[model samples]
Target: MAMAADKPFTLLDRCPPSFEKTAQGVCKLHTRYDQYDSIQGVGVGGLTSSLPARRDGFTPEQIDLGRYLFFDPLLSVDSTHSCASCHQPDKGLSDGLARSVGVSGEEIPRSAPTLWNTAFLTSFFWDARAKTLEEQMLGPLYDAKEMGNNPVQLLASLNANQQYRSMFKQAYPAASDDITLDQIYTALTAFQTSLISLNSRYDQYAHGYHQALNQREIEGLNIFRSFVARCAECHQPPLFTNQQIAVIGTPEPEGMPLDIGAEKTYNAPKLKGGFKVPTLRNIEKTAPYMHSGRFDNLRDTVEFYTKGRGHAVPEGVEMNLHWHIWEPNLQDHELDLLVDFLKTLTDESFMPPVPKDVPSGLTPITHTVQTTTMINHSNSAPGKGE
Candidate 1:
């Protein structure tokens, strides 16, 4: 039986944030959650969308156009990669590797996070660098390693296409200008914002559907809320995260250079190890997890949380910033339940299908990819086909 089946689950009932004590704050919270739930049916709420939605929403034509742009490798300088290359739909919108490869096939720092429910995030990037999803849209677009295309070339490619010109006419009838880089980013951002993931088992569980989670998952929930794991502290109600930044001391993997996670964006005072706390929603599919994409599976991730980072420490030990003092050891069954519980976060409905036709009249480019491949790790890889 589900643990909360017997009684009303007092999920949360604290004094709200001090700033939120007034009527205006309460109304603001309601409006945010209402919009958040309107797009994302997930049961939890907070400022998760990297920023508030722009007034401009996508039309059917714009969605089709954006879908094409997402998959077209021609946007890249060398025509070697697309957004789909690193953020594969099947892999929970992530590539399931530590660092992603560039258009030139060179490895770059950071992992690709799922676009699912990103509409709710108030800040974007693992470092929480970008303030809005619109701003975040342009990062990979011009990144040397990712899209690698300059705005001039990108705009030229779109302008040359008849379908894009027509789609732009339909999307922005007033604008005399046919196509620009801003329009392309706006379309892509709208589509990304529309990528809402909810209707997961966890949502059902939260909505009083007692059957959503099985016996193990129920036990896992208990432990997750208990002092032993205390995941609820940061990964709190609804969205499963507090939307705050913290420095969890995950070491830099061998052969990979130390990425001062938040320091690069926010400066040294924010702490050398700090990174944004990512939502655990649909976590099972988004593997090779963490900002650096270090761990391969949920078991490894759970172990990392329980054991804590082994070697590296945050700049100041006395600060004790985001360091978690987990239970020294976890039992086998306990770990099993935790993994099972996390699986409930999966929401297949949120996954977007590749568009059949691009608004730009571009054909979806196909690439030869190795199936079911795991990235080679120096710690785990065998020597000489051993």
Candidate 2:
């Protein structure tokens, strides 16, 4: 079970920046303003048809504070990794690695998923362990292989910092103390929920802008939606996800233990290899696909679905072949068209900028380098599973 599941952190109690406080101290959020002002608009046809219903109260101040916290390395035990370190904006909010390297410089078992359109998701993480974004925010921090910061110590560290204290005060004026774990989670969740990605060539086309997509892209769109490829069955448009978990039979890394993805939380044999269906909104930018990051590029990923590269299932494990709708018999040109359509989902405006400096005075982000010896060793050895 998650640590802070018992805490009360509802959207109504913590109002957004746009909210007006009543004389009786009741909070109400205003949704009248054009929230899409900052990002490019999708015009009409409601391209973001799958956008999850917005929560009532998120303040601009809270978002600002969360942004700082997300980029700050102080949240980590060793102060070497920040949320942005693994979810780099330049790399489409995902580290450009098959598997992520945690604070100890050890490889994490699974791929770091992109933060794009997470507000639409009912659950967070590949395993779907976190039900709310607030819960998800604290997950990596507590994970020993990830940030590895104890919740008590983490709160103490933040409370000691005058800058964070002031920011917290401004974000949550109702709070008696300078900072608390709930407030931290709230602020972080607010910022992450604000990350919406709807501006793309496909979006423009969907919104009645006929000329937005070219001839090939249009053909690709047809192929994606057609039964021949059936790409859109799971990767449905608007948000581009069916919001379900399935075992598509992706091959386990050689020598690694079987990763019982959703089963870790659900403990059901039927869900043994099931993983959450990630949004393909900015799919082109977030490369190294699948739960294991087994496929390196979009072409390979498309081919996997078409040709089914997944290994045979182990005893007692069932593969959800219903979700695997890609027709292996698709012509090569049709496959090219499918790839072209997927690329249309790339939206550059969705990328968040890395902060020049963080509150802790530590570097906001750092690149991990593998020595020649390490690379040679990896080449000679097989991978270990989670």
Find the 10 residues in a row with the least total lDDT in model 2: 1-10
Q: Score residue 369 of candidate 1 by CA lDDT.
A: 29
| Candidate 1 to truth, TM | 0.78
Writing each residue's lDDT as its tens digit, candidate 1 over 283-346 gives 9998888777778888888777766443355344422357454454777788888888889889
Clashing pairs in 1: 44-238, 48-120, 48-121, 49-119, 49-120, 49-121, 49-122, 50-121, 50-122, 50-123
What would the TM-scores of all predictions be? 0.78, 0.82
Model 1 accuracy (lDDT, Cα): 0.62
Q: After superposition, how far is residue 240 of candidate 1 from its true place, in Å?
A: 2.0
The superposed Cα distance between candidate 1 and the true structure at residue 10, in angstroms, equals 49
Q: Model 2: residues >4 Å from true position, as ranges? A: 1-50, 308-318, 323-328, 366-386
Best by lDDT: 2
- Model 1: residues >4 Å from true position, as ranges? 1-60, 308-320, 323-328, 359-386
Measured with C-alpha atoms, the lDDT of residue 331 in candidate 1 is: 78
